[model samples]
Target chain A: MTKYSPPLAERIARGIGHLMFLLGGTWGVFIALPVSVAIAADPIQLAIWGVFMGSGVVAAFAAWRGLYLIEYATIPAMAAGTLIYVAAITNVVATGENPGSGLALFLMIALFSYLTARWFSLNQLLDGPLKLLFKRRQGLDE
Target chain B: MSIGTVITLIAAVLGSSTLAAIITAFVNSKRNKSQSETEARAQYTVEFNAIVAQQNIQIERLEKRVNQLEKAEDYIDVLIAGITNGTIPPIPPRI
Candidate 1:
């Protein structure tokens, strides 16, 4: 019997998904929450940070269980984080302050978002169109 | 550069790179599948040729055996005629 091996893209995507889970967990629990508390952020700001924290917990759980939910949970958080970082950068620039840190954070979030999106897209393709195409081709060959 | 310009540039770079990565992955996956299929077909062809070769060898052996059997039968027919016409002596009875 032939050994079942996943495609290269799928292997890459799974690696990215696991990385996202780790990054999301770190960002939510260690970075976002502590920073919000240290800054004595307002309720609205705290809630925004809470989203990251929640996403991180979900990502960790999904990763632990080896579920696809990691991709779903992290992508939205990364997207929201990217937007928040952009806004923070603009605010810093308006105050005549160096926006370097904000920009760096923004870059990180943007990169994570891109990776999560790629993972999601690749998984979708593998399960849907690619599988369908392979099935149809097999049928035709038969 | 202004903050807006920098942000725009970053967005454009990220967007284009993401699109390119996905498209490349899709194309590469298709190429990988086709390559595997070609390899499997080549392997199967090699196996089939080996089987055919083995069968041919067996058939040649069978054909040789059949020729030997036919020649033996012809010799037996000639001996039977000689014995019946008394041109060749038959085996003596054992005591």
Candidate 2:
């Protein structure tokens, strides 16, 4: 009868998903920020980091602005964007250089990840899969 | 990187993101609007059929009544012909 009434198992699954996401996002920032700050030293590196991380920032901004469709775009953007940044970070660490702007850039990464995950969770709430499951369960119960 | 390069890169990234967001949003909104419109149209059709069915029932009932009235009128005409031909004695009226 209600539009949304997910069962306990589904709720638990969602909760676990969220917990992992939180741990990943939080720890990633904590770890990467120091790493970024340590590695980033040159203006060229800063600009590169900024350009890459800016994609996620834009996604986070869109999510923050409540642009639903555009927000999902963060997924691919983050994928490609994060890959470049991580590679750059690895290069810096390999060269024994500290990326001073790592924190600034990775901060955007954290925000983008957090927002996109929230967006996905919200989408799951409106998903028809749960509704179908509920119907099947109801039929069995009856 | 030069300040110009930084600004250009920033502009490129931001510009692309803004464009992507706008296009995605526009396409999705249009799709949602179309889906809802289709649902509305289907709902309207169902309602229209229901109203037409109701009207049809009324019309059928009216047609039956008309058919009965025609039969009754024919019987009355036969009775009047009998009276005019004097084949049956007219019942005396009680004044």
Candidate 2 docking quality: incorrect, acceptable, medium or high: incorrect
**TM-score of predicted chain B, candidate 1:** 0.52
How far residue B93's Cα lies from its native spot in candidate 1, in Å, is: 87
User: DockQ of each candidate's interface versus the true one?
Assistant: 0.02, 0.03
Write down the TM-score of every candidate: 0.35, 0.30
RMSD of 2: 19.1
Error of 2 at B12 (Å): 4.6
- Candidate with top TM-score is 1
- Specify the poorest-scoring 10-residue window by lDDT in model 2 chain A: A1-10
State how far residue A26 of model 1 sits from its true place (Å).
Answer: 7.8
Off by more than 4 A, model 1 = A1-41, A102-106, A119-123, A126-142, B1-95
Write one digit per residue (lDDT tens) for candidate 2, span A54-122. 455455544444443444454444543444344445445445565554564566567457645654543
Q: Which ten residues in a row have the lowest lDDT in candidate 2 chain B?
A: B31-40
Best prediction by lDDT: 1
